[model samples]
Target chain A: MTAKATAPTPAPSHRGDAEWLSMRERGTVLGIRAAYWLAIAVGRSAMRPLVALVAMWYALFDRKVVRASRAWLLRVHGRPAGFWQVYRHLRTFAQVTLDKVYLLTDHTRALRFTRTGHELLAAQFASGQGAILLGAHLGSYEAMRAGGETTDLPIEILGYFANSRMINSLLARLSPRAAAKVIHLGDDPIGVMTRVQDSLAAGRFIATMGDRTGLTDRIVRAPFFGQEASFPAGPFLLASVLRCPVYLVLGLYRAPDCYDLHCERFAERIELPRQDRAARLQQWVRRYAERVEHHARSAPDNWFNFFDFWAAPPAAPPSPPPP
Target chain B: MSQTDATLEDQLKRLIVDTLALEDVAPESIDTNAPLFGEGLGLDSIDALEIALAIHARFGVRTVANDEKNREYYHSIKSLADFVRARQGEAQASAAPA
Candidate 1:
């Protein structure tokens, strides 16, 4: 049964969740606009040093975030991380965030994007049988959107905004068209399903992140980075319900203005039978985790989840015998 | 129920119980009109996909892959039986000479 939330609610705050929450709340649209205009005027070449300086400031002041980044980098890199490594990690995130200004403002002429497996998306579009693009927070999702604009395929993002009120208005102000494509998960579940169905039926691609989960979102445990981690079940469920093909898409930020966009066909369709629900779901989740880990290892800093990812969960007592 | 149709329904009911591992619910106890999903048998999207696979395996009839479109066919045992019967009829007619 679909959980009862027609509207987005506050995601339970873990360290990682809080970082995302605070990052937006700490800065206003005006501030983002100022950075955008500055980058545009001086060019990314001139803005690099300034962005690094800002990244350094955050790394120094935000102890919690730095610790989280440092811990993740250690696992991803398989080596001890120093202050400079952590700083670079934070800087990568800042640079990508700043680039959104250029991306949304229709000034991405300088950024270079190389896409692989784009033919899969093209084929899906050509067939008028749309597919689901399951993405993660590892890189610049905006780069994918930029590519979508160029390819002329309609892309709608499915996301749950914890502080959507503020961000939504900013999105409306910055790019009204972009704001319209967002299918907020916090809205009514049935409404979300209907809208998603319409989009798929119209052969438009729906982009959703498979990495994160909402406060109430049901999740399954899978092996990630050599340890079991919780991954959200919503993406697979959506694919099964839609009966659509699934594709894995990632836009890895390479340099100042270069990104490598990768698209891999994940599955023709998700077929989960009731008899082995847990095991079947686990297999799919494991495959996704392995793929994400492969990408994250290549670009360690681009992995945006800044939390104690490997922390142990609260204890669970043994279950009673079944009836 | 006619012998042939009764056997078809009984076969489908058995498949549902076996594929879904609903061990507690006996095949004969499944009300043909009782819903198979949410608020009925309390199945979810995953369960729906599984049932589709089971249907394909047992009857050699391909249910429409899209859940939105498949809702009518999967609504209950009666609907599923009718869907299978219709498809099997079409297959037989196409194969027979005029």
Candidate 2:
């Protein structure tokens, strides 16, 4: 029997209420399987109309996703997002998602990439001291990964995958080699850290998302797109603890068949002194958030965070005014 | 608990307090059996990493990541002390001879 779908209510009550981790995957396994095989068989160019249909389906029926896309587009464009704009946003997401199939299947010969700041990655590789690749949910990280694979760079993905198990497993099956490179973050904190340290020591890049926070993640608020939003401090904190260089990498999907891969050295090392640890974390996280904002604005349709990005924490009870 | 285990736990408590710069929390006030994460002390994974680093630096015992018993070993001050002591024993045994 198919699992009953539970639509997540978007009411902002607690921090977990708006957390992306609490949201369920949108499509069904059977539907995803069919789409995957269809994309693989008919190729990306032929699947555009079908993908648009799927994106349109979500845009029309999935009220939560539509509301989120509209809100995000409004913030970035400084105007109410029209229905087509939201549709385009979802369509971009769908197109990028479809590309992951080709990316993982070793069929990247057809893909084209224009990389900026590639020398930064080259320098780190030459130094034999692996760097952390900090990316966001803005664009297709898989594009960057596919590029790394082509260039013979050993890149491992470090992420939490509980939410997208179905798709992750499907992609894993498509490319066991790529899936083997994943370091899943789970209950075993020590295990994860040890593996990360070992990978860095061995000069393998660890790519992780810096935007979304897990349910129990420590967070710091940063101003993004003219409003304060919570960003996870874990990525910055891990960078500091690992004492490694960090580089901001984004693969903006240009329509049709091109990806503009942008890479910039973010920091040599993030230092969080005990005396001002919280402030230091805030500074680093804010800087990262600013970088994400810059890219998100440049490629507004590439923005993929389909949640209430600006949900404020539950309001504290007001105190009596001084007499 | 033996006196030495108690002493080790106290030492770890002080190390955690100092390493994490946990303001408003006295080392002695920390319960030996109270959870260090998500509840009693409310420490998170970052804190766990900090503690692991400090434990390695102070005790010369590396807390191997990916160990199936990491969750158990890092559960509390007492458990951490036990983990350190066991690792120290293993180190000594290995360094002794073939």
What would the per-residue lDDT of candidate 1 be over residues A1-323, giving only the tens digit for each residue? Answer: 00101112433455455445444433434456557567778877777887788788878887777888978977877888999999988888888877777776657777898888888888888899778999998987767766453345677777775455555666666666553366666544434665676788888889888887654455778889988887878888778767899999998998667888888999998877666867888888899999999988888889877666655543322322221
User: In candidate 2, which residue pairs get closer than 3 Å at backbone N, Cα or C atoms, i.e. clash?
Assistant: A190-B65, A191-B65, A191-B66
True-vs-predicted CA distance for residue A291, candidate 1, Å: 0.7
Tens-place lDDT per residue, model 2, B28-85, is 9898998887678877777787788788887888877668999899999999989998
- Which candidate number maximizes DockQ? 2
lDDT of each: 0.72, 0.77
Provide the lowest-lDDT 10-residue window in model 2 chain A.
A1-10
Backbone clashes in each candidate structure, one number apiece? 5, 3
Model 1: how far residue A50 lies from native, Å: 2.5
Docking quality of model 2: it rates as acceptable
> Which pairs clash in model 1?
A6-A187, A6-A188, A7-A186, A8-A186, A273-B50
Q: Model 1's CAPRI class?
A: incorrect
On the 0 to 100 scale, the lDDT of residue A274 in model 1 is 64
State in Å the error of residue A187, model 1: 2.1
